[model samples]
Target: MTFSIVGRCPETGQLGIAISSSSIAVGARCPWARAGVGVVATQNVTLPALGPQVLDLLEHDQLEPAAAVERALNANGWSEYRQVTTIDAQGRTAFFTGKEALGVHHALAGEQCVAAGNMLASIEVTAAMVHAFENAAGLLADRLLAAMHAATDAGGEAGPVHSAALKIVGDHTWPIADLRVDWADEDPIGQLDTLWQAYRPQMQDYLTRALNPTLAPSYGVPGDE
Candidate 1:
């Protein structure tokens, strides 16, 4: 029981995914992205392997999102139980909600994004997510957060969502942001947003430290002096 958005920033060429679910640790199982490649969200009886398989096709096989999704589905006998959405580096997108996907499922493909949901309060949840992502301002992460908020406002999962995740990949192999709330009785999206606000300022610093420790600023921890 999950809803998610996988999108590319046209201006920055960054790729990211924001997702939430009634299940725990949705991040570890659902969203996947590769820098300069694409993003994928696999849910509804999620086959975790499909996320990486789709990315490999996009990155090395020169396959577009639609073709890659088709290939991945064909390789799995349980495809009919899975729901997947993908967006390529060029903004081409594709999605599928298997016939066996849970209640009130829908998938929407937008300009540079694709959203999917299963066991949802309503089909409009996916549509709301895409609309918010397309119109929201600020950084890609903020836009993604806005989309999640819209999904929740539109009706969210059929049941209470206990977990949420936000992930973004930029030019480097490592992710620029990877935040998750494995489980929360309250608002997981709000928790994720708070983590993003705290992490945003230090994002570039972390990258700088990795690339050039000497040029990076002080750690700012108690014992750094």
Candidate 2:
């Protein structure tokens, strides 16, 4: 029901996740990331809490991606229906697709990324995403969009996808870029891309405000104008 990419940008050392699903509000339900820690995408039958639990193991327990994923799965009784992918800061990665997953499910890893999908129209979609993310140019967000486009180009999920999300963690506890399309009948992924583009220019300003308001730029909204 979902396809996602969890990646560590080799150039920036940033971690993020780009995900889409046929289900509603996949943004709030699937992706999770921690600054200087790791990223997780938990889908398929979809246990939302598993995302944070995996990150907890990575951040607090100081476990690597594989160990953290294994521990999280072992602790849960519902592993058989979940497909979760995890990637740590060091480019270490691991994935699990339970026996109860949908149509065509698979996970593939790249130099600093992992792509996974369940109920996919084609198994090659995940591979295509990894290739796109690895070979694409520009910022981490752009590369994530490229990988998402690759998945759709290769025939994404078995059904029409309705929601999408992109979450990137930098130096703060909050995401540097958290963009989501909770649901869209037409094109959620495209909506996500557009939202990211609109936010890109203001991203730095917001971060500056968070770290040092005196140096941050003006709001440029109605009141400021």
Which pairs of residues clash in candidate 2, taking residues 3 or more apart in a chain or in different chains? Answer: none
lDDT of each: 0.93, 0.92
The weakest ten consecutive residues by lDDT in model 1 span: 216-225
TM-score of 2: 0.97
Pick out the ten consecutive residues of candidate 2 with the lowest summed lDDT.
Answer: 216-225
* Residue range 1-225, candidate 1, lDDT tens digits: 999999999899999999999999999999999999999999999899999999999999999888999999999869899999999889899998889999999999887888899999999998999999999999999999999999999999988999999999999999999999999998999999999999999999889988997877886788653
Query: Which is the leading candidate under lDDT?
Result: 1
If scored against the real structure, what TM-score would every candidate get? 0.98, 0.97
In candidate 1 the C-alpha lDDT for residue 21 amounts to 94
Please name the candidate that would achieve the greatest TM-score relative to the true structure.
1
**Model 1 pairs whose backbones collide:** none
